[model samples]
Target: MDDSELQAIRKARMAELQKQQGGASGGAQAGGSAGNASNDQQQSVEDLLIRLVRSGQIQKKVSEQELISLLEQLSQQESKANKTKIVDNSTICELTFPTSVLKVKMNRKRLLVILEEQIYIYSLKNMELLHVLPVRSNPRGVCGVCQSPLHPFLAYPGNNPGEVIIFNTDSLEPVTVISAHKSDLAIVSFNPPAGKGSKDDRLLLATASEKGTLIRVFDAVTAQRLYEFRRGSMPTTIFSINFEPTTNKYLIVSSATETVHMFKLGEPAKARLRPSNSETEAPAASANKYFTSVLKMLEPQRDYTCLRIPTNGNTGDTSSGNGKTKNLGSANHINREFKSAAAFCKDMVVVVTSEGYLYQFKFRSPEFKDGELVQQYSLKSM
Candidate 1:
């Protein structure tokens, strides 16, 4: 179209929008919004302060002390809110399977599985059957399978001929298709730290591929890529990206190498994105450090065990040693830790090993200081 024609089209659209704003209180398809835009409320005081700093609105000489004070007050408020945050390790439900190699899908209501390319949705209320949907592809290299934390979509990151298909739970259909950057898939884990407190944040799915370690964060609702977190020296494998239980950050991904990594979903604790100074530099800003020595290691004797059972009690000699089955034997039967899935579900971590055994345990962290994952829990016998 010509310039005059384009201008006329824009004018007509603007007039229509004005008419809608003047008359309507709520549009049928507009989610939480009206045409008038009166609901676009003022920003919070803390948010305003951030905007001022970000937009360079805060004058350089308008008393640095005063701006510092305002920022400190905002920090205090945020800390108070985060202090009340509870660690959600509550056991929701469990799913039993005959075969050890099974995929899992879960929400507040039920657990779904894809075994032998047949989808089985299980009810969480009674642990009964729901329905089954048959998959077309031959189940070959399917490793990581779980529902997205943000939406009602299921993801399986594996050797699907270089592309991973995202399926929906309610309809049992392929909703959106995503892939590794020009290669076969490896491991995929949803970033758990997003969408806190009923917020609709896009689900961040990190995928490993044969090419390298690629991070693909996507909108769970639309199934579109948002940001990509890239790393140096290519990860050993995609399965290397593991997550840890933390309110601060969602992922604790590591390679086969000695170093482990931590990532944040929001504004980092001590980082700000600087304006681009060079073309060669990356766009997004990040604050990550390397683990530097013997301090990187955990105390093997005291930690790494699921739980410490009290073998020697106050009155051990009085009780009969034969009748009461010893707890120490069960605890020490396996010196090695469970080689389960890098990611875990509620109250239970599914660990897999070279030997065929699916072990379940409550992954609890009594503490996390510096960089150690001091997890302790009781083992569940099948």
Candidate 2:
């Protein structure tokens, strides 16, 4: 080859090498950011995200081994500033009572509490019982009275006709028996946010039974049935049902299958009225259209091995319009985002295994799109 042709080929090879080095350096920085997402300021995250622009794909073309190499590169760029690690082999909590605790939640103040035979409302601040309330449930974890974000009163499915016995927290008595469903209801919930209902009277919930694979919604105060959606033909044991409190229009329900379904609460009310001037909503909605969910900060679905939604607020409609069923992001995607860490939830998404172990995650997500998953921790760890 002539001198000119050889010189051109050398220049092309040099450019390709430069491109590879840049990619390597970029990957290292991204790995570091993920390793220490919690530490990086908002400004740094913005810069990193710009560099690692991803090509959205239905399936992963990158292999795990190759991905790991890239991830290591990214990790190198990050400071690894949070070098302090907890070495305790023991868990954060020791099992005191051997009760097979099925339900556990935190209050608005982020107090870690568990509800088994009775309500254990303990204060996380000083590790003291703030107050104890009496609760009643059947073998399959069915009780009308439960702690939910929407309603102060706890309601669980009764033994008959999808019935629910509502209990007043202050009185600690079954004040009402509402036939919330036709079948034996497994759980009850509000439509999500408090007071988002028909005439502000209905509460939404889910009913699971060995009899069929279906979920039904009901009006808690009015005893009126709303809608019944056929979950599937499989043994309709609904494991988890979560209603977003602020939107009051989404339900994240997990069934016997490995997948979780997210349905948006549709605006079914056909009236126009002024919103109440509540501290959080009235002024905010009136001024701007940026109302966030109270439960948005809590983890959605982390421990798939065992997970449960604090069943309350079923007044709204869960209509991820068009009846589309899309698989939520994979576990790795969830871990990448939640790796940084967010605030804690006192009582929100919870689960309990057969070994009498209780699992909890404070569900938190920046966006409120249905089916978008945000896990608190790795399922493998639990």
Clashing residue pairs for model 1 = 306-377, 339-352, 340-351, 340-352
- For residues 270-364, write the lDDT of model 1, one tens digit per residue: 22334345666543431221222222221111111221222212112111111132233332324543222233333333332212222222444
Tens-digit per-residue lDDT, 12-35, candidate 2? 543543333221111001011011
- Cα lDDT over the full model 2: 0.37
User: Over 4 Å off in model 1, which ranges?
Assistant: 1-100, 125-150, 157-160, 193-200, 210-212, 231-235, 240-249, 266-369, 372-382
Candidate 1 scores a C-alpha RMSD against the true structure in Å of: 21.7
TM-scores, one per candidate = 0.41, 0.41
**Each prediction's Cα lDDT score?**
0.37, 0.37
Q: What's model 2's lDDT at 361?
A: 36
Q: Over all chains combined, what TM-score does candidate 1 have? A: 0.41
